[model samples]
Target chain A: MHHRLDALLPLAGAILFVMLWWLLALSGVIDPVLMPAPQDAAVALWKGFADGTLTHDFWQTVWRTVLSFVIATAIGVPLGIALGSSSRVYAAVEFVIDFFRSTPASALFPMFLVIFGVGEKTKIAVAAFGAALVILFNVAYGVMNAKKTRQAAAHVMGAGRLRIMVDVTLWESLPQTFVGMRSGISLALVIVIVAEMFIGSTDGLGQRVINAQMVFDMPLMYAAIFAAGALGYGLNLLFLVIERRFVHWGGK
Target chain B: MTSHSPGSPHITIRGLTKAFAGVPLYDGFNLDFARGRITSIFGPNGCGKSTLINMIAGLMPMDGGQVLFDGKTLRETVIGYVFQNYRDALFPWKRAIDNIAYPLVRAGMDRAAIDARVDELVTSFDIGFDLKRYPYELSGGQQQLVSIMRALAPRPEVLFLDEPFSALDYEMTLSMRDKLQEVFHATGVTMILVSHDLEEAVYLADHVLMLTRRPTRIAEVIDFGAPRPRTSATLSEPGFVRAKAHALDVFQREVRRAP
Candidate 1:
């Protein structure tokens, strides 16, 4: 009984949240133009899906997010390994990495706009840049914290520098690398959506939200925002499944 | 293989000196490990036995001494070190078989040869457990067995075991001791083991080097001339008891004299 209650707790909380939102809308506590009723938003979601606009926007956002994530992973993994393996390399780049990591990628939109010239490339590049820094930081620390005994064992077994890096260092850092990848992908999706909403984009879930708000289509705006939230949650769940499969011995 | 006499030195440590934070551990220390024998170094806690073996293994550089292999240079010689913490020593991600195959893989052996070698070791040891399971899934004793197997994988001329069985339960320790004795007899590899347990030191070793505390030197070198393949029954034998008592006597004397 307790286990069943524990399992249903999240669902109960979600229902309660929705109930509170509906009550506020029905009571006229907030402007209906700003916060549409739950039923109106549900209708708008169904209509958008039927018209294929929601599907196109969803796929576009997903494509940009995946592309940026891949780019970030490709660059971040190797750089992180190198930096983590060598103290000299880490010291050389630590300050620069820290500076970029602390500076919000959104704040650099104007600079990105000028450099990549207001296109999909600019938005993708900015998201990829942010994702890369996150992954690189995680990967470096993972490498740095690779067990000393394992490395020594490899060394004593007559493994050379490069061989040890591949055999010992790389596998040791894998659990941490997965952590970085998951967070990196999430950040990539967030940056891509923000970029779509702010930077010039013709189609995306973000753009739909903006377009609906401009036309005072409150239900459509709320539906698009809900779609974005679902997308983030879905992507995060996907990464979690992958992590569980690949890094089974992570905490053990 | 060039056969040296039973008492001939395999590794010689000359004029060794080591210090930690201005306190001397080994000052002008010298020792010789015999060829093709199991030598156990037993001392009190924090006596630098592990440090000494680490230096000899070339895992840690000596402060001023040279550890010279009798006929081969350090690089030319293959060494295997089984760490005390088997959990950290064995790669958790790799399966038992893969961990055993690691040193062979490092030696650039072909896949077929590596598999054959691992299979031979597993068969010779008569290991009954599943080799496909990852290290974490194995029991503590099994994990240490995997560690020992990895060390033996390279067919190392010298195997350094730093308190290999200290983490095991009483039953597991006894079983591992028998397993270790079997390996030693089969391979005749020169084994240097460091232990905190005096009985374990006397049982596993053909020769026991008992050390004093810091500024450590060999307080006694007691030889257990008992038979090979020492069993649990051997632990009660007259020679084993005598050897253990002598080691304890030397250790007590050394501790009493420490300033």
Candidate 2:
């Protein structure tokens, strides 16, 4: 009973949040034009999905984000492991990785635009660059800090260095790699949305949100914002599930 | 059984030298370990007991040394090692059974043969817990038991255990001790154990190798001939008591002595 109650707490909080927003909408302290009723926003979301216009935008954002994340993981995981495995190499290149990781992804926009000429490839390339750095640093640290005892155990068991790296070091870095991938996708989604909003784009949740704002379609704008939010939350949830499945013994 | 005479030692360490931050921990150290005997290393704190074994096991580099296993370098020898931190030593990503098979996998054994060997170990060890579960899912004793299984999987000629039961509870420690003794009896592999507990040092040892303070030297090597299968009852036996008392005496003298 206690566990069941604990599980329901989050649902209760969500309902309460919506109810508070509902009450505020009805209270008229703020302009109704600015803060539409929660019901209106819900109906708008339901209608947009029903009419199939918002579906295109939602899927577009999903595709770009997924592609960027895929590219980032491909580049980051192997590169990170290589850098992390060698102390000399890691020391030589640590500063560069840290510098880019600290810089905002948005700040690289003009540079990316110049290199890729303000099109589809530019958005994804920038997002992948940002996410890759996040993942690379995480995977590198993960490999570097893998438990010494486990490696020693493998060594004493008569494993060669290459075998130890493949058999032990790679598996040991898995949890952290998942962590990187999870956060990488979220950052990718953020970058993809920002790019869609600013750069010339025909469709996407970001484009829909900005388009609705210009046309004074508050309901559509709010609905698109909620869709983007759901996408982010869903992506995080997906990666979390994957992480648990792969690294079941993580943090145990 | 292999012949274990002083004239023909199984392992010979020549001029083993190691320094920590320019302070010598072991300098020009030479020692011999008899084959097919359980040797327990007991020493003062920071006396480099684990360090010495690590160097011999080729897990750590020595400043200078030649460690020969019956006239071969460490690379030419097959050995097993169990660590005190069994949690860190275990691969959490693999199932317990797979972890045991890991060494064999590295040895390039075929899957069918590996399965046969792993199954043999599971039966011989009389393991009750499910080996399908990962190491983190099991209790501490079970994890250490897995480590021991993994170590023995390769059929190593020598086994090194560094305080393998120090992290376990008293009940688990007793059971693990019995298990280790059974393994020793069955294999007669040249076994070396490093321990801080004097009673454990005496109880499990054919010879207790006592060491001095830093820049450690052999204080003494006391032979313990009390018959096994040693149990809790043996802990109070006259021979066990005598060995323990002697080891403790040497330990005190060395711990207080100037390095």
Candidate 3:
């Protein structure tokens, strides 16, 4: 009985939250323009889906996020492994990595815009840069912290440098690499949306939000925001599932 | 059985010197390990027994002198080292069978050959546990068994076990010792064991090399001429008792001499 109730708790809380919002809207204490009714937002969500505007914009944002994320992983994972494997390489580049990792990724947007000319490239570059740093940091630490005994065991078995890297270091760093990928993808989405909102974008969920707010379409604006949040949650859930399946021995 | 005279040294160590954090552990140390025999190294806590075996196994570097193998350089000779921490020694991600087959896989053995070798070993050891489980899923003794199986997979010329049974419980330790003896007899591999337990050293080894503390040296090398397939009864045999006592005497004298 308790298990069943526990499973329903999240749904119950969501229902209560929506009911409170509806009651507050009915009370007329707050402006409807600022806090639209839940039903009105639902209606706007349906209209956008029926007209296909929401679907197109959603796919556009997803494509940009995925493209930048792939680029980040491609550059960051190998670089991280190299730095982690060699203390000399890590020492040479440590200061630079720390400096860029600490600096807010948004601060680099002006430079990216100048180089890429405010096109899709600039938007993708900013997101990829941020995501790469996160992945690199995690991968390097993972390689550095691999258990010493395992390495020694492999060495005694006559494993050469390349074999050790592929069989031991790569598998050892996998759990942490997954962690980096999850956070990297999330940051990629955030940067893409921010770019769409502030920088010039022809069509995206963020563009729809900006356009709706300018025309005082509060319900449409709220619906677009909800869709973006749903996308993030869904992406995070996808990563969690993959991590569980692949990294079953992570905690062990 | 192979002849094990002082003249027939399979591995000869000369003037080995090593220090940790500027404190000397082995200063100009020297010894010879015979082929086809189980040699146990015994010393007090913090002694350099593990260090000595690691250096010989070429797992670590020696500051001075060199190790001369009978027929090859250190790199060309196949070696196996089983660490004290079996939990960390075995790869937790791989299943027990995979761990056993890791060395063969590294040697680029074909799939059928690898499977055949692994199956042969499993049949020889006669360990009835499921080999499909991950290392972490098995008990401590089972994991260490997998580690030993992996070490033997490469058919190493010399197998260095750094206190392999130190972490196991009494029952597990007994069973693991039995398994080690069976494998040792079957393969006749040159075995070097670093041990702290006096009785265990005598029970498992054909000869025991007792050492002094830091700045370590071989205080004495006592040989046990007991029969093969040592068992619980061997622990109480007169030969075993005499060898253990001789090792204990040397160990106490050396430890007491330290300032």
RMSDs, each prediction?
Answer: 2.2, 1.8, 2.4
In model 2, how large is the Cα lDDT of residue B151? 94
> On a 0 to 1 TM-score scale, where does candidate 1 land against the true structure?
0.94
lDDT of 1 by residue, B85-169 (tens): 9999988888989999999988999999999999999999898799999999999999999999999998998999999999999
Name the 10 consecutive residues with the lowest summed lDDT in model 1 chain B. Answer: B1-10
Model 1 misplacement above 4 A: A1-6, B1-3, B21-23
DockQ values, each candidate: 0.72, 0.81, 0.66
Candidate 3: where is the Cα deviation over 4 Å?
Answer: B1-8, B236-242
> Which portions of model 2 show Cα errors greater than 4 Å?
A1-5, B1-8
How big is the positional error of residue B121 in model 3, measured in Å on the Cα after superposition? 0.5
| Residue A99 lDDT in candidate 3 | 96
Decoy 2 TM-score against native:
0.97
Clash pairs detected, candidate 1: none
Maximum-TM-score candidate = 2
Number of the top lDDT candidate:
2
Top-down lDDT ranking: 2, 1, 3
